[model samples]
Target chain A: MSGSVLYDAPGPRARARNLVLSVVGGLLIVGLVALVAYRLYDKGQFDGAMWDIFNYAGIRENILDGLAATLKVFAMAAALSLVMAVVLCMGRLSDHKPVRWLATGFIELFRSVPLLITIFALWVGIVDAILPVEVNIEPMWALVFGLAIYNSCVQAEVLRAGINAVPTGQREAAYAIGMRKTQVTASILMPQAVRSMMPTIISQLVVTLKDTSLGYIILYPELLQTARLIASNTQVNGDYPYVPTVIVIGTLYIVLCLALSGLANWIERRGRRAKTGIAPTEAKVPEQTGALP
Target chain B: MNVLLDNLDLFREGFVGTVSLTAGSAALAVVLGLIIAGFRVSPVPPLRLFGTVWVTLLRNTPLTLLFLVAFFVVPQVLFPGIDSYLLAVVALGMYTSSYIAEALRSGINTVPLGQAEAARSIGMTFTQTLRIVVLPQATRTALPPLSSFLIALTKNSAIAGAFNNVDLFNIQKVLSNEGYNILVIFIWITIGYLIVTFSISALFRTLERRLEVAR
Candidate 1:
């Protein structure tokens, strides 16, 4: 009888208003969908040839290669970023002030800059300026480095938040037992922080996965870049198939990200039912520090 | 330094462009996010469904992909004559709305049951209870996270720079291509972004502190 937070059950007039409002809202959404369908039809975007371009083996192989490359970069970046985060968070939580400041500054600066710029700069800087005439750096490495740097900063902060979430008494008790600072931090704090913060770290990994699409800007031949190429280079029914290519490629990205998100959710739910004596408080889901794609 | 001084006009244009891009999209995202957050928590099944779909679709896609779609596909097929800048604004804003909605939903979840129950006991309508008792507290709880999203939006605007938007990153491309040092180009552009993002965080922090004091 009383569980709804905002309002009670609707009365007669309220029900009528709600029905009319929903109908209008539903109609508005349906109208939008119809308009999009009509536009696509008129433009011949729904034509068979445009959709059938995927029948080409070469194109499918390109998409698969792109997907593989994307995952490779994600895997490398994910591993490297975790290592970087541990180092940075250790510096951040150190008893020493300068190391803490240095780490904090690094995180803030990189965190504020766009990942696209970082990738582009790395591409140009390494390829054009840094490397010798005979030496070369791959575009894949540029993209990987950028994603790792930016996401590491974010992950480090997430780690810090998790450590902070540990009850202060947990730390004080360790100190009371004459445990050294490093011993308490390593043996006691780090494990609990990582456990409580697993969901957030995985969520940031999703951000890292999506960010690989920025590889397109640097001509890294990732999934989105492959889509751009296929859309621009292919010809079908006198049109470029930009719409179809985007739809297909966008679906791939959505599916991949959703799968990762599903993993995060599973781990989070499992964590909740985890039966530790008195489980450490779960860290808040880290606020997103990067842009939505 | 000379390169920066010589390209001050370009730098200024990019700075202003980023500021406007951020301001426009922030306005749109905040408004749309609030509406979607309403849909998410409303006592109607359809609205809740709609909100979930919107968040999932937007959140799962890449911003660069959205830029490609918004800049290339939509203008070509859906709205033949739409301005590129306008397209960028719409895309960026729409992408951001998902995060904002998520932030606000979490905020709403944090509101005490007693607060809402007390409002209902006073015979407040849903809209009134929400607008008065719920949203203010929600916004308070949501402000810290919301600020991070806005700063991320600023950096994300850099992506728009490559998409025909004359933002800070655009200046980076221009100056770097002009045979200037890449390091110098990055330094200046980075400073410009730091200014905008730092100002945003500061503004949000002050606003949050003000709200705290009032409470």
Candidate 2:
């Protein structure tokens, strides 16, 4: 703590100021939202027939198809990224000077470079130079490879921190038990490190999911890009539907992320339950009673 | 050498865009991040949930996507005819704020609980404890990661190139496309990024040193 708080809570004057600020802020938000709606409305996005287009058979099919592609690409990129992360992590942690330096350099270099540049460069390099022919190896792959390369560096650091957080005594105990270095790393250290850093790991995965949208820049047609195409296609009265479509699309992203967050919370709770055996409510009850003191 | 000499003006312009965007958005983001971090660790369940959701959505989403979403999709959806520059700021600010929230939250977490408890024992309100007591310490600990995120933010602004904006990478792209000096232009852009990153890292190192000396 640096210093003591000068005020208790906001007094009336401060509260009034806060209220005014909030009202202004609220208006700004609502005004922006209204402007978006008005643009869409003016463009006839809200036309009677257009509103029902979500029920259109072809549009529904297109959304599903798009969703499938989004999931497939995200899954592949995420898996490959994890494998690369482990490799990079191991390399960074290695005792060998050359390996460590190479890993560190690669991590820092890729991590510093923009993901879009990586993907664009990789796409051009592979198609124009690396590959024998004009093969399209899923621009989505390029995006993922780029995402994975950068994120693996981040994951490697996270894992390294987790590994370092483990007590030296644990490693010594493992060695004393005649465990090989590999056994100590794989069975003991890695597991504990991963468990401790599970939240960070999960958070990174969320990043992976969001990064899937970057595929749009290369015309890979991930969710946001597809939504843009849908919104802009003149068939939907150009401007108005673009806003609603984007809102719907953004909301979809919010929904997916929130679902993932809920899952993380569930896992955290289950883990705590497994450890304590007593329910959280029951655990809190004792604390509440002790609060009397 | 001729190419570098000829394209110097464009390089300078691009560098300006990158720096301004990074600095402006970063300042707003740090403030927003502090607020979100407060919400994240707040006793109010709803406030905490709001903060968590914010971090999750913004952090998980790709920065480029958010950039596009903010620039194109967000304004198009929310306020049909909002200014592109404002949209850019809003999107970048929100996206950057999420990462700041994460960095700050971790920083806050690292602050010993006793610090806050001691503040409370001294009769400080929750906001008081957080502002006067908690945040200053968190700020120091969070500096390295914050600087790292700023570097990341600067690099990510390269996506502004895709938007056809006159940012550094886009400027380089334009110069290369027009002059056909591809390698030099890209090398220039790369150097520009490295300079930004290295300078920030150096600044952080200096700050860390000063902090140590003060201690």
Candidate 3:
């Protein structure tokens, strides 16, 4: 509140000034929206006929198919990435020096490269070269592997941070109990790490969902690709339905991502409520610094 | 590789385009983000609501969709002369700004309440207090995340290639089409991105150290 210590409560003059400023700001925003609306209207982007293309069964089915493909790729990538994350995290955290270096190199290399290039490389390079001539590598496979590789590195970092966050005392205690290294990691470290890093992990999953759109570049019939095809192919009143198609697609993406985050929030709440195993010791972990979507 | 040497000019142009896209979008994103951050922390409920909505909508949608809208839909409706490169910049800027705003807001929160209180007691206006007292400190905390976001933006800018923007990724595509090894082409593009991203990371590290000393 303005009455908080951050600022003094407004006097009459200050109150009037605040009102004027707010009104001006409000008008500027409204004017900007009106300007965009007017331009769209002038271009016939707001025509009902353009939007009405979605009513067609073929277009609707195409969109649904695209959504399914996108979801399928996302599901595979999400599962593979989590498995890959665990493997990489363990490798990175390995006691052996060569293993640690290999894991670090892999994570850093993939993490630095753009996800699009990774997908492209897998599609054009690895899939072509490694796979037998008889075996067909679908764009879906390329997209899933590409996403899994890149996101596994990211998730590895998140999991590593969470693993490192587990109390040293817990590790010491586990060692004192004569547990093997793998046993300590699997039982003592990983469960607590996953619990602590659940929010960040889920957020990364949201990112993976968003990144699925990149599959469209590799000729994958994902949601964005389908939307583009629809918009380009369909015409209403002699104008392409680019505006309406984009709106629908973008809205779908927004809805899907929001739903994912909402689920994450629910899981986090449930995790907080369940009083199960050993509570993680409170430690101030340094914030992980990286480009997170 | 001989392919890279023979096509130096193509690579140069692509590299330049990628740099321009990254720099232009980063600049626009920072400015837009600052304004949105202002809206977020403003005392007015409506402004706060507007900022929240902007971040929510933009952040949830993928950058590729935004690019499609900007390149295909926006230019058709609003700016006819705008090219794909410019549309890419706009789309990248708009999408990245949401993250920037969130980072700046977090930075702003780290500025102690007493700082604002003291500034206000000294008769400084809210704008003056923010500009002089709050944002300076906020910038220090925000720099690392801002740079990371910019790095991410550089990578995300590759999506422009799909829309006919001849960035580094596009060059890789072209080179591959010309019978060059696809793996080699990808490695080159990957190196270009690494150079850009690492340079950003290094620059921010230096800036952070200098700010630490200043503080």
TM-score for model 1?
0.93
Question: How many backbone collisions does model 3 have?
Answer: 0
Write down the C-alpha DockQ for each prediction: 0.58, 0.30, 0.55
Model 3 clash pairs?
none
Query: What RMSD, rounded to one decimal, does every model reach?
Result: 3.0, 7.7, 3.0
Residue-by-residue lDDT tens digits, candidate 1, A123-169: 77734654456445579999999999999999999889889888889
Query: Which regions of candidate 1 are displaced past 4 Å?
Result: A1-3, A126-135, A168-183, A277-285, A288-293, B213-215
Maximum-DockQ candidate: 1
Pitting candidate 1 against candidate 2, the one with the higher lDDT is 1
lDDT of each: 0.87, 0.69, 0.84
Worst 10 residues of 3 chain A by lDDT: A279-288
Task: Please write out the lDDT profile of model 2 over residues A186-292, one tens digit for every residue.
Answer: 99888877776666666666666776777777788777777767756635533335545655677777777666656655655665656632222111000000000
| lDDT, model 1, position A14 | 81
How does candidate 3 fare on TM-score? Answer: 0.93
State which candidate has the highest lDDT: 1
Docking class of 1: medium
How accurate locally is residue A23 in candidate 3, as Cα lDDT from 0 to 100?
87
